[model samples]
Target: MTVQPYVPEPLPPAGIDWEAHIPRIASANRALARYDGILQAIPNPRLLLSPLLTQEAVLSSRIEGTQASLEDVLRFEANPKEPIGDAALADIREIINYREALNTAVEALKTRRLDLALVCDLHRVLLSGSRGMDREPGCVRTIQNFIGRDAQIEHAIYIPPAPEDLSGALGDWEAYLQGGELDVLVQLSVLKAQFELIHPFCDGNGRIGRMLVPLILYDKGLIGSPMFYISAYLERNRPVYYERLLAVSRDGDWNGWIAFFLHAIEEQAGANGRKATAILDLYDEMKQTVPEVTRSQYAVAALDALFKTPIFSSAEFFEQAAIPRRAAERILQQLREHGIIAVLAEGGGRRAATYAFPRLLAITEGDRL
Candidate 1:
C-alpha cells in the first residue's frame, strides 16, 4: 500500500471565459430581469424596503456558519447584546457592520461613479477594527492565506493577490473600466466575479465582491438605486455558488457560473419586488390607521422615519419623529396598538425597549427572496 503524492496544477491566468459561459449567463440574466420587472412595478416609500432587504442579505453572509435563523438576526437588532442561542454580542456587532457597509456601498453608487479607491473604502468599512486589518484595506496579500472552518480548514477558500501583483491587476481592471466596451451590467457582473477570483485582499473578499456588483451597476448607470443584492442568493445556495466559482477557474465553466449569477439576480430582483410591494402596502395601511389611532404629528414623523429605517427606539423615534420625549413614547405605544411595530427586548440601557416592524421583519427573514 503506497500513498500517491499530491500534484498542483498550473493556475489559469486571471480572467473569465465568457464564450463558454454564455448560456448560463443568459439564463441567469433572464431570472434577474424577471425580478427587476417585479421591483419596478412596485410603488414608493416601499422602495425603502431595499435597505432592510439588503441588510438581511448582508447578515446571511456574515453569519454563514452560525445557522442562526432570521428571527435571531431581527432579535439581535433589538437586543444585539443578547440575541438568542449561540450568537454573541460580537455577532450582533458584525451584523450591524454589514448593514453599515451595505449602506455605504449603495449610497456611494447612487451618488457617483466607483473607483478602485472606493473598493478600498468598502473593505475598510467591512473589516474595520477586525483582526484582519493592520494591513491597508485594499492591500494585496504578499503570501497565500487559507480559508476554512475551525480546525478542519477546508472552508478556507480565498487567495488575495501577491503584493507585487496588486498594482498590475488593478491597472488592467481600471483600463477595462475606461475602455467602455462591455455592456455595463455584463461588465459589472463579470468584473465582480473576476475580482473574487483575483481575491486581492487578505480579508473582506466576499463582502467586497458582493459590494462590487451593485457599485459597478451604479457606476454604469444601469441602476440609480442599489436594489439588486446577491448575498442572499449566494448564501442560500452556498454549495452551488462555490462550485460555480471554482468551475469557472478550473474547468472553464464561466457559462455555468454566469448563468447561476444571473439567476441570482433574477430571483433576488423578484424577491425584492415582492418585499417592496408589501412594504408600500404596509406604509399606506399604517398611515391610514395612525391618524385614527393618534392625531399627533409624531405619528406622521415616525412614519417618515420608518422609510429611512423600519425599526426604532424611543430616543431615535423622539429624535426623528420630532415630538416631546414623552409624546414620542406614547406614539410608539399607539403604533404598537395599531400593529405597526412590535416591541422587542431592550438593551443599551435606553429605558424604553426597541421595536421592529415584525411583518416587515418576517419578509426580510423569509426563505426565497
Candidate 2:
C-alpha cells in the first residue's frame, strides 16, 4: 500500500481561540526580546561558532523523529555513549542529512526570497528517501492521514487542499513578512504554524514545518544565518508542542501556538548563540596557535565540519567539507598539529585510520546533547 499524506481539516467555522494564547504570546515576546539582545551583543567575537551550532541544531531536530524517548535522545546527543539502537542511528543519519539541506537552504535564502520554491527544495532535501512523500522530493500529499497514540495510522483525518493552495498560502506569508507588520520572531512562529495547518505536502509535514521556521527568519533578515534549531526545544517540550498544534486545529488557537513557537525560537536561539560563542572561542584560540602559514584557508571550514560530524573518518570529512582528497589530508594533519584533533588508528594497517575532533568529539560524546 502506498503511504498517503496526513492533513488536518479545513479552517473550521468557529475560528481559532487566538486570544487564549496570550500568556504564551507574552512569554514568547520576552524570550525573543532576550534573544535579539544576545544576537546584537555577540558577533565577530562569536561568528565562527555558527557551524557548530548549526550542526547541533540540525542533528537534534532529526533526533526528534526517531520516536526515541526524549530523555534517551538527549542523553545520546549530550554525550553519545554505548552504541545507539538502530532506529536512533537511522534518525541521527536523517538529522545529518537535514543539516545538509539546512546549509543549502541558508545559502539559497541569502540569494533568493523565501518562496515556495525554496520551501519545496527544503522538503526535497528532508524527505529525500523516506517512505513519506512517495519520494517525489518536494511533492505535496493530496491524501490525509493521522497518527494515533499508539502510532496507529488512520486515514480520512483530513484532506489537504490541492497544491495550488500552497502557492496561495506562501504568497500570504511572504507578504506579511515583507510588510513588517508582524515582528520577525513572532512572525516565524505564526508562519510555521500556518504552513503546518495548510499541510501542503502529502508527507514530511513535521520536518517541513520545522524547516520553514528558520527559512522565514533568514529571509526576513532576522537571523544572520540558519544556525538555530527548534527541534531540540520542541522535542524537549513535545507534549506541549503537540497539544498547542492541536489547539490551533480544534479552537484556532493561533495565538497560543504562535506564542509557544516563538518561545521555542527564543530559547533555541539563545542556546544556539551561546553554543556558537563557545565554539568560536575555541576555534579562534586554536587558530592563533596553529601555524596558519602551512595550512590552506579551507582548513577552518574543515574544522567546522568536524563539529558538524565529530566522529567521522577522513572519507566522510571530505564529503561534507567539499574539499579535494589531497587537500583534505593536508588539512587533517593541520588539525592534528594544532592539537585540536587526533587520529584514531586501528593499527597494523588492518583498517583505515579515523580522525576525531578531540574536544568537540568529547562534547558530543559526553556533553551538549
Candidate 3:
C-alpha cells in the first residue's frame, strides 16, 4: 500500500471537545500564573533570566539534533578567539543564534504585533551563518518539503501542506494569534502544533515553532515575562512529544494534544519558577558576599557583571565590569583565590583568561549538562 502524505486540517478547530479538559486547562493556567508572578517580582528579569534563556536555547536546539551543551556554548562564548573544531564551533554558533533570535523576537513583540513578519525575522536570525542559511532563511517554502530520515519525499515520515496552501493556512493562523475566544493556554497549544504542521519556513521551522510558545503566552498576557522554559520538558519526553503531535493529524485528537501540551506548560512552569527563584536567591547571596569576599568598593559592579555573563574573559570583565583596570585585576585575583571563579582556560601575554562561575553554571545547566 502506498502511504499518502499527511495534510493538516485548518486552524481554529471547528468542534474541539474542550469541556472534558477544563480542569486540566485551569490547573495549567494557575501553574503558569504562579511562575509569572515569580517572574514579575524579579527586578531585573533579563539579567537573572539570561542563564535560563541560554539553557532554553540549548534544550530547544537539542530537540533538533544540535549537540552543543550549555557549557560548550558558554565556554565558546567566553573565549571566541580560541581554536575549536569546526563541528563544535558550528553547533555553538547555532546555539548562540537561537538565543539571539529569541531575544530579537521578544524585543520586536514589544512594539509590533506577533505576525508573520516577526516570525520571518526570527528565522532569519536563527539561520544566519548556520547550516540553514541556504534554505531561504526568512522566507516561506516555495516548494514541497517533508520530515523524515530519508532524502526522498516518497519515504518521508510526514509531509506538510503544499506550498500553495501555506498562505491561506498562515493567514488563518495569524488571525487566531491576534485574538480568539478560546483560553490563551488552550489556544497556544493548538497554535504550536498547527505551526509545526504548516512548517512555514523551509528550514528552522521546528525551532521557530517552539520559540512561538513563550512568545505567544507573553504577548497574550498569560505570563508576566517571556521566560517560560517548556523545552526542558519536551526534550526529556522527546518520543511522546512527537507521538502526540502526530496523533493530532492522524486521529484528530485535539483533546489529547491539548492535554499533553497543558501538562508540559504546567510541569515546566513550576520547574522554571523553582529554578528562577534559586537563581535570584543566589544573586542576593552573591550581592552580599561578593563585596565581603573581594573587599572592594567595586564589588557590586563586578558581581552584577558576573551574574549577567557568568562565563567571561578577564579582559572582557575589566572592560565591561566598568571598574578601574587595577581594581578589576585585584578583584578577579581575589575571586580566583577564594574559588568564586575557576580558570577554564589560560591566555598568555596580554591575552585574558576565561573563567567560569561553578555554582552559577551548576544551577543553569542542572544535572543534564
Model 3 quality (TM-score):
0.97
> Which parts of model 3 are misplaced by more than 4 Å?
367-369
lDDT of 2 by residue, 12-96 (tens): 2134344665566566656555555555655442234444444454445644455433234333443344367677765654664
Pairing residues by index, what is the TM-score of model 1? 0.79
Q: Tens digits of per-residue lDDT for model 3 on 1-369?
A: 434555666667877777888988899989998999899989899888898899999999999998989888887877788789998888888889999999998889789878888899999999999988899999999998888787987777778888888888899888888878568888999999999988888888888988999999889888868778888999999999999988887778878888999999988888888888888898898988899999899998898888878888988798778999999999998999999999988879867899888888888878342
Candidate 1's residue-wise lDDT over 1-369, tens digit each?
211211112222235565765665566556555655555655552345654654664455553443434445545553434425444544544555556776787677656567777777777776675445565655666755544444333444433345566667776776665457434545655666667766777766776787677666556655545566667767778888888876655565555665677667767766765766666677677778777787886676767766555565556666766778888777788878878777775635545577777766666656553
Please tell me which model should have the higher lDDT, number 1 or number 3.
Answer: 3
**What TM-score would candidate 2 get against the native?**
0.69
Please say which candidate is ahead in TM-score: 1 or 2.
1
Model number with the top TM-score: 3
Model 2 residue 182 CA deviation in Å = 3.8
| Candidate 2 Cα errors over 4 Å, as ranges | 1-64, 67-93, 133-135, 149-179, 292-309, 314-350, 362-369
How many Å off is the CA of 15 in candidate 2? Answer: 9.2
| Native-to-model Cα distance after best TM-score fit, residue 170 in candidate 2, in Å | 5.6
What shift in Å separates residue 91 of candidate 3 from its native position after superposition?
Answer: 0.8
